[model samples]
Target: MISIATALLCTLVIRSVVSVRGDEECDASAAYSSSGGKICASERGDGYGSHDVIRGEDRMIPIWWNYDIDQLFEDHFDCGQIIYGYDDGHPDDDHDDDYVDGLDDQAVKEQHIKISDPVSETELEKLRYQWEILREKYVREVNIVPIFHEVKLDSATETTGVDGKGGFVDRPRTHGVSAIVVPTRIGDAGPTKGRGVFATAPITKGALVINLDNGSTGLFKVGHSWREFAVSLPREVACNFIEWSWVQTVPPSSVIDEDIRNGLSIFIAFDESNLMNSADWDDVEANVRCGFPPKHEGDDWGPCRFHYHATRDIAAGEELLLNYGDFEEISQQGWVDIGL
Candidate 1:
């Protein structure tokens, strides 16, 4: 059941009008109206689940794990603040600014920016600054190895194959940011397969498109483990985890650490950063490319995050695509890349 605080949080959340809710039964409002069945169909090509289902269709983003509602409210960490607060940190701070001249701080909370305004630029800047400190405090392993994504089961034959379920990393600390509602995003687009992430503005090169820290309770970046992972989960929840939008498989021939070689399927759960799409090697050559920001100059690096930079210049209304593992390389190696 949704808590009173959670319900209040939703009233302040920001939302993209064109979020990738499919046409049939995937409406976000419907999520609130009904308990889940196998009604909402899947939209990806990765053959894992026959279809995906959202238990609360009204919930804006898919959550792989639950959050502590009481603590979130006690700390004044409203999930709605995530959606309603500063996104890309670009709204004006001046009271004379026409866009938000009249709306008091209390009134500036909505999924759409119509009646709302973001937190002050100072607050947003401070949040970004705090993120820098966290990255330095917890320097762990870089996790994009080619072996962790080892569990692959043939759905048609119902056959499971894995020499051993690979490494499973303990959940990381939460980042400061948890609100998924942002205005810097465009409506969803699908070129070859499922939905992809796009920019609402002309994104500059080396721009930090997204960041995930361990402290943000809404997001969880975990390693896949078949033996101890989601074994007893219901089909809808389990399969959705398997076809993780954030799970990127590093090529086999690419030499890397011995420990991280576990078919690198970094399982992450959250809203925007995790929901972006994957482009093949050539689909976005003239546009944005993904990179891992080194932990310096006030930037943190992690296995799950691959920041997208404009190869040349990405125009507004362009889809932001990350180059995923080469299918041929994974196929040639004869190892199926599974999320969990």
Candidate 2:
């Protein structure tokens, strides 16, 4: 489904060159046939120079949630102009300086030194000024997910058991509410085992572990119920959503009231939040609990909202676990269960 505009926008033209045989250049009529049907090839030369055309790969970069197609086009166009149009201003010794001798000296110099029209040095600076803003957004959106790692506690913490016998246990085991806890994983016998979040740093009780804000948690197929949306998608796509998404409850509000009854909204964690493993409700293994941000007087609740806070102090390198409750129940559906 890639369009012609996509191809043009993705390809960058670096330089132009022509292949020559000895002292004779290929005639215009034969040039197209000689270079494998490409008038401007990207291969360099042995006395026959060629264009350095480069095409960007069709890969995805994490972008802001609020960005649209128009904004992306504008930013890409501006960035391309700024990057490709830049020159070091070094003089070419191969060119003749006498060509400009009789011309308006100042006018020619100005023409040579000026940047591309509509994009001036001031505009570049202005774009540069937005670097911090973009960086902040990137940090909040991308880096908000904690690092996923696996750790074996080889160097166990030393402690005296009830009989006063020295024993090795997990180190620095602090027990209390934590202020923050990053979305982490642990190796345990659970439904969603093998995947876990490991803490690279110590997290205090009552600390914010990970905030799966609306921007990061993608609301997939906004339907009244999970079954309704899952049935509409293709088999594989529907299964993926069923496995990864949480049935989030969007309370009745002015912004959205369709889920007024028992129906809940479906959302998938576009980030690493989806990788978190669940713990049983009766177990003490669950250290973090999901919560929504406090609503202000006018603040509206969107279809997706979630954040995990540490229920107790979590030591560095400890694996984080959550009691999924009914949030993860939808994953129970299968090809036969959903009649796919």
Q: Identify the candidate with maximal lDDT.
A: 2
Q: Give the alpha carbon lDDT tens digit for every residue of 1-340 in model 2.
A: 1122332332232234443333444556533422122232212211112111212134221121112222222221212222222122321121124543555778765553342222344323322222222223223333323322222333354331111111222332222111223534332323224334577677876577766543344342222223333333332233334455555444444455543222344454434354455666335577766654234656542332356667678887777767776343445332222222
Shift in Å, residue 204, candidate 2: 1.4
Quick one: best TM-score, which candidate? Answer: 1
Off by over 4 Å in 2: 1-192, 221-239, 252-263, 292-305, 326-340
User: Per-prediction RMSD in angstroms?
Assistant: 19.4, 23.9
**Per-residue CA lDDT of candidate 1, range 2-21, in tens?**
12233233222323322233
Candidate 1 weakest ten by summed lDDT: 159-168
Model 2 Cα displacement at 22 (Å)? 59
Taking all chains together, each candidate's TM-score versus the true structure is: 0.34, 0.34
Which stretches of model 1 miss by more than 4 angstroms? 1-183, 190-194, 212-227, 245-265, 281-286, 292-306, 326-340
